[model samples]
Target: MAKTQLNVRVDEDTARAARERALERGMSVNRYIEELVRQDTGEAGHTFVEAAADFMKQYESVFAEEFGAAHEGRGEGSREHRNEGRR
Candidate 1:
């Protein structure tokens, strides 16, 4: 694929950390940044929510057996109560 150069200005500390991360991952800073962009744009596949949902689906039977029918009676009020102090 044809690629274009992108210039981004970040703080020196951020740049240093990014370089260290790239080295740890055995990739160049350019490739590391490309991966970050890809993940941010959802081009890397299986976002966090999607993956979590998939995992839940896969373990639905086990979770249901462990938790039993208790979850069904829980209403939206429980969520509202839980978030009461946050915002």
Candidate 2:
């Protein structure tokens, strides 16, 4: 499925906590945050990942059409070309 990027800002303390908790779970910060969001919005026996896959399967072409060909055939999310925001 095509993947996109999301960036968020938080205070240092919040960032530290996310780092520590992600470390405790032995997962990348990205996957850890994904798990947290999954738990928050998920129903028992159904995961956010499953729902996401289903949605993507159903609407991926629509997204590619709406967003443009640049959004097509994308793999994992990338930050390689991002412009840094001002502090």
Clashes of each: 0, 0
lDDT of each: 0.88, 0.77
Error of 1 at 75 (Å): 38
Clashing pairs in 2: none
Model 1 stretches astray by more than 4 angstroms: 46-87
Cα lDDT tens digits, model 1, 31-58, are 9999998899987776767888999999
TM-score of every prediction relative to native: 0.52, 0.49
The TM-score, computed over Cα atoms with residue i paired to residue i, of candidate 2 is 0.49
Model 1 TM? 0.52
Model 2: per-residue lDDT, tens digit, 11-87? 99999999999999999888888778867776423865678889999999898788766654343443432333322
